[model samples]
Target: MTRYLEGQTAIVTGGMRGIGLGIARRLHSAGAQIVIWDLAVDGWDSVANGFEPVMRQAVNVASLASVEAGFKEVVAQQGRVDILVNNAGINGPVTPCWEYPPAAWDQVIAIDLTGVFYCCRTVIPHMRERGYGRIVNVASMAGKDGVQYISGYSAAKAGVIAFTKAAAKELAQDGVLLNCIAPAMVETGLMAEMTPEHIAASKAKIPMGRFLQIEEIANMVTWIAGPECSFTTGFVFDLSGGRATY
Candidate 1:
């Protein structure tokens, strides 16, 4: 491993487990300081045993105030945040849109979509002032191709894809670069939240005949959040196993 990010610091929302955890571990292996932000992270120490200097903070991404406070705390301690991975999102409910509860829809939008907006809003100024930063928003293949029974998740992720593009353009002149990843149904704990039928349908859609692996997402993110990804921003990098045609 090349320790390319030797002195950089990275914040991974929902990083205590699953895909987020995989990404955090990979970034740490590359020598970037790791910060995990989640609603509850009780046993994080056991999982992050080798991650020396790993910091954990309680962050409810749905709240703008919480996002602001979390960013402030990271900056106050680390002096600066060089990378941010917005990976804290829910799968929402497995139900038809017509039958979806309004509250559930709002919650999905809040965490998956608006939450990205809030974090970026809070960090953009600081990154802009420093003239260097990297932000990787985790989106989904469902956002590009709507999945049945997961309308809320689909819509929210679509919003994330658009948000990444728009924000990247605004920061083009600055050293801050923003990009998003749209992965197919990834094998993670979040899949447990989906119905068997929903999972089956999603898997069948992938040309590779398998769900995406967490490490695959982590690999893509490692490069995107690193210094080599200089010329690309405002783009959606697909990890769909041939599911994404566009």
Candidate 2:
């Protein structure tokens, strides 16, 4: 692997399994120190992947104080964070809008939208001070459209896109490049948890007729986190395998 990211540090939220972990491994192989932050909902830890000298982090994206404490600890130990990947999100509840449980809906929004907000709030300021930063947000293709049965997720991801755009503009002059990746029907464990019927429906919509591999998303993020994205901010990179028209 190239050392394009050598001497850099990355904080990957939800970085224990699936998409986030894939990103961590890829970046590490490319010579970036890894900070793995996951709530243990899926037993996600960097040690399992044989990451030497991993920065183990315990974070609760729903709470601002938890994010503050977690990132503060990471910086105290690692010194600085050069890249921040906000990949923690939820598919949210499945039900008609009127019939969805208020708690479930709020829960999804809390993690997907508010979580990204908190991470950006805590990490970007440091980036601004350094006069450099690369922040990649993992939004979904559903964020660009209204998919049936996951309204909360769609809305939250949509918020991520808009938020990325605004933040990018604000930090562009500060050398902070903020962007969001919108992927469709990725074959992460998240998809594995969906009902077979829902999975089939999602597959049928993909023009490529298959879900994306975890590495595919990681590859996209890797480039965005590197020098290649210096000129691109507030941009949306599509990884839908042709599922979305726009």
Candidate 3:
């Protein structure tokens, strides 16, 4: 079978583990040269998956300087970036909006919202210069529905969704398609940060009555990052397991 993404280069933020790693694996399997960008590179060498990133760089996506340096390195090594999956995020503290810590809220916004902006700001020029690119921002259903007690995470994700749409429109004719996915609860390391009550409440809201599998998310991302995802820009793909009313 011909690999659909042959010779392409993909950068997956937070790719050392969780949903990001799953996306990296799927893209690598589809023939994209993968680069894992995260704050650490530990545990990746021990992952059982046969797939390995062509390169791994420690990057703090929330810092524009760090993002710029990381992308500079990627371009120097790979010559070009064909796809970017902005999947790095934190769930932040689960608390009522009024009672949420300022520091915690800022942290979530910095990583989950500002980080995506930084990555896109740095990568778009490269993609525009090359006349091709695909960007998938991993948002959440919480962004749309506004989960109670997780105001920081929900607000940041909502920003991501809005940013994706605006950026897609800006790059519409530039051959860079930008989109976002709003997935319901997915069982990932991030879940450990959530309260048991929050987790239970989230699952109960899902019509599917279960958390999403990593592979299911990876499958959607694989297609979105490929050339076949043409004609769909500035759109939000829902992976809410029937819980999304909109």
What TM-score, over all chains together, does every model reach? 0.97, 0.95, 0.98
Q: What are the per-residue Cα lDDT tens digits for candidate 2 across 77-134?
A: 8888999999987786666788878998899989999999999999988999988889
Over 4 Å off in model 3, which ranges? none
| Alpha-carbon runs more than 4 Å astray in model 2 | 41-50
- How far off is residue 169 in model 1, in Å? 0.6
lDDT of 3 by residue, 83-185 (tens): 9999999999988899999999999999999999999999999999999999999999989999999999999999999999999999999999999999999
Better of 1 and 2 by lDDT: 1
Candidate numbers sorted by lDDT from highest down: 3, 1, 2
- Top of the candidates by lDDT: 3
Displacement of the residue 61 alpha carbon in candidate 2, Å? 1.0
Looking at model 2, residue 107 earns an lDDT score of: 94
Q: Which ten residues in a row have the lowest lDDT in candidate 2?
A: 41-50
Cand. 2 TM to true fold? 0.95
- List the pairs of residues colliding in candidate 3: none
Q: What TM-score does candidate 1 get on C-alpha atoms?
A: 0.97
